[model samples]
Target: MPASTEQAVRVAVLADSDTRWKWGALTARRLVAAEPTGFVLRGRATPTARQLAETGVSTTPPREVTGAEFLREVRDAALRGEGYDVVVLALVGGTVRAVLQGLSELALERRPVIVTGYVGVVYEKLADGLLLRHGADVVLANSRHDAERFRAVYEGVGADASAVVEAALPFLGGAPYTPEAGRDTLVFAAQPSVPATRAERVYLLRRLIGHARQHPGREVLLKLRSKPGEHTTHLEELPYQRLVRDLAAPPNFRLVYGHMGEVLDRTDLLVTVSSTAALEALHRRVPTAVLTDLGVREVLGNHHFVGSGLLTSFERLDAGVRPEPDAEWLDRQGVAAGGDAYASAFDAARERVADLLAGPALPPVSPYYTADTAPGYLPGILARHRLDVDAPEARPGGLRRLVREAARGAYRHGVQRVAPAIRRLGEL
Candidate 1:
């Protein structure tokens, strides 16, 4: 809690996507007794109205703003001497770096306790992501395995690792799994950019449809991350929705979207290539499998599950092979099987936060990559987000807002329309 007696602790969660928003908001609540105000970073993967509504996490609606606009808001708040007690940066590495730089520029008298972390399993850009997130008061690691890895990455580079705190995925909560009598629902959680290709996506979809064909009595769902023209954390260049249009699918199988936890409620079996949904399902003791039909490759991210005992092929699933999750692996990964452990996952984080809040004002946010350290690198990151040492101009409005929207619309058009057409032509 904050030093203020009149108001509760104020926490601001800034996120780039719907999934990140869920993680950020939930993590904010878990870390302290606070109701987080949400800010959606306007970008390609900006959460849609439907996606935001589906999360059902934040009580207040999120304010959508570009990177510059967000920085202005923070700077203004700091100038007013009314900054949030905590600000959770639920964004990508580059954006995190940019925000850190922007904050350092503010040099406020009372800076918020900055917190940042990964949304899920970090199969890619381990060093890049961890280092970019370095200057926060808390760099949360979602598992013991991640905590160790994060420390190693920082210590390897001689950077301070004190900020890396172990915590579980904040979104991991639901009713424990129980056997459903008839029409068991099998959901194949889909990622936007994993196995990033039309053929690979189609093959996975066909495999899912094949399973549905084999188990006619069972209900199968392709739990999509985003609908058409809507992006998630990753860009869906070749969506399953576009490919499924040509495929002849069975009535038992269909595409579904919305909250993953709700879907897992009736899920008899949950399958994925390497989605974080696997962790969510495992937390609830839901039958989960990391698909091996695509091969246990790092590119597909299933390599992260090698020792989890959850990796199996669609063939095995078709043959009724339900994997018993490795208990040790689950503990190491911080996916609690309910009870006291799961409840206490954020205890360390909470304590760390309390200590920070009670202590003297925090030093300026000093990211690892600075102009002094990485003159060639740091500028590019900040420039990408239009951030600088000086206070930003007023928030985007009138002509500026329209111009930004037009540019964003053009970029989205290139992604959702022009680029896919080019890919299809190239294939031909």
Candidate 2:
């Protein structure tokens, strides 16, 4: 592309320091390198920021911006006669939903083209087919199986039901190893919330403890990712901690917290209750077993990649089998599919953004000026600020209520100490 055309095609990504952001940053770098004039707008707090900055990529200051702020920034840039060729909202779940709702209200005129990558599971109400149906110009799935699943569910919900499965960031390579006898080491990656899954994780950990005792020299490592200070109490609160504590007393069992990449690399076999880490392990050609407890087989099942050395089990893993992933297995796991598919998905998103920009400008949908247009937006913001004021619940049902209360407590306890600025913003 010519310099003028390249300069006109700026791309901005809204993401943080997560796996998805790492992939998005890689893709952005590739795109900008292809078109030298292309610029990347990235959040300072994003995990990939330092990596990008090392490569001489310009970055914006870390802001406590939400999905609403993301959209507003894009719009503001356009209003100031500065428009991007594409604005990619690489957020998952509630954030994505908020962005869509905000866009719906804006009635944007000459809006910069918008695109989004659906990187998380669509099983939850906040991150399900509803958001997929209304949020993006094009919905991109991490796997073909996921794409088909999304279409089936969305079709039932009267959604457009069109989506492309693209290999998620950190593209996989062909599997190189065959199953070989190795030391007995098991690794488990923890997920964010959803107590049911956490319970399952506890159960799996207990089972692994038993296995370690039986196998003598075998080892079990539980990888934990909890906020500081909260980690000790949270672990102490688990019903299985007694088992874990006993196991920790022995030389065979260990608890490893933090340093995810290093832990994964050292593990012999990986086990997960329900986490995207299983996919990450797959990339490393590690044999992975996913526990199917909590009656969540349909949602957390690993049956789709059975032939790929990725096993789903409700029971303990058998000791004799040496699991190894092959090239054919990687292909089945969507590793054979090239990165171009992901790029194509981005292209489709670009088309949708063009359509939006070709139309008229829109007005703001959210009246409260908080992050989301949803009912609990104000309260959620206030709770984060530790304002000591009661706000309406963000989600429906008792479970959401409990989660909000917990979040509020987290905010009040220590989040306020880390950043008193949110309180100032809330006051304003």
Candidate 3:
């Protein structure tokens, strides 16, 4: 029997970091007619309180869970005959695969409609990421171009491409760009670890400061992702915040951190190396530029904007250049600068989800990797999340569980603190 329309749709989102949480929660809203519950995976990039607040998701705080704890929750929910109607796994490819395997072992009579996809530009690990996310009921492609590429990758690997559904970046929304009288703000959206080196970060910082000095009339806002101690979707080895201290910045220049959409409201020209904020700005028809100051390299991810027409340099920007995005390129990338197309961007995804909810019970998630397929490969991915499909009884309890938590904390400390310190020493 199909699920009755009278009852509200129950949706849940499991995401690892701040950006993913924002993407997943907003996506669930577009896919279903319900307020989706949010869950954050406790990890190295588990969102700080301020980070969560800045996303403006909801007043209801999200529950934080480990891989083991989340799996257990799913099992418990299944046992209680209260599984979610839809679940968006907003996590890395490996994490998604592990969760799929873990859920499959539960052997529930009904499984939630699983959904997963990249949060932004699919610049790296195309094959590896796609394969890991293969078994989701809806592998959402954020644009028409992405949908084609996703399908091609799956079909090339002889896997089912039926799940690649077209969608848009759920968080892409703001009032259309309009100039504020006498206040032209230049917002440079900063990423945490794109440049990854101290020198590169320092150079970018100096350039930004220089730009502020050159144009005293324009308010140059360096939009940051997180605070000094906070972690974002990516790790920051050499934070702009630390580097900017060494330079004497102008009064017109300032560091700001808030919702990108809120910042975009005041932005006349949005600039970045390769941050997803470029896409958001374009969607709002804001004049945007992807910096080529570091060279248009794949590692910098600015290469993703090859034909975007928004790719330019600080030299061009400093000389008062605000490049307009190509309409064809915008359509391909699903920015839909024209309002109508973007309004209906989620139509296909919503339809697919509705059919699944109204259909029979979903089968076990069948990820691309398995013991028979990738014997050596599958186990390591599962083990990283402490998920052992073969040995459920091996999970620790009581005192052992406490010790495990302590160990996990120590590991996060090493990654967030000790590792960065070692990298800084190497620079010296």
Report lDDT (Cα) of residue 50, candidate 3.
77
What is the per-residue lDDT of model 1 for residues 98-173, given as tens digits with 9 covering 90 to 100?
8887777777777889999999999989999998999998999999999999999999998999999999899988
In model 2, which range of ten residues has the least summed lDDT? 228-237
lDDT at residue 25 of model 1 (Cα atoms): 93
Clashing pairs in 1: none
Worst lDDT 10-window in candidate 1: 388-397
Off by over 4 Å in 2: 1-4, 15-62, 120-135, 152-184, 194-201, 228-249, 257-261, 292-296, 299-309, 312-318, 322-333, 336-428
lDDT of 1: 0.86
RMSD of each candidate? 3.0, 9.9, 2.9
lDDT of 3 at 110: 80
lDDT for 331 in candidate 3 is 93
Ranking the candidates on TM-score from highest down gives: 3, 1, 2
Give the residue spans of candidate 1 off by over 4 A.
1-7, 388-402, 406-428
Which residues of candidate 3, in runs, are more than 4 Å off?
Answer: 388-397, 406-428
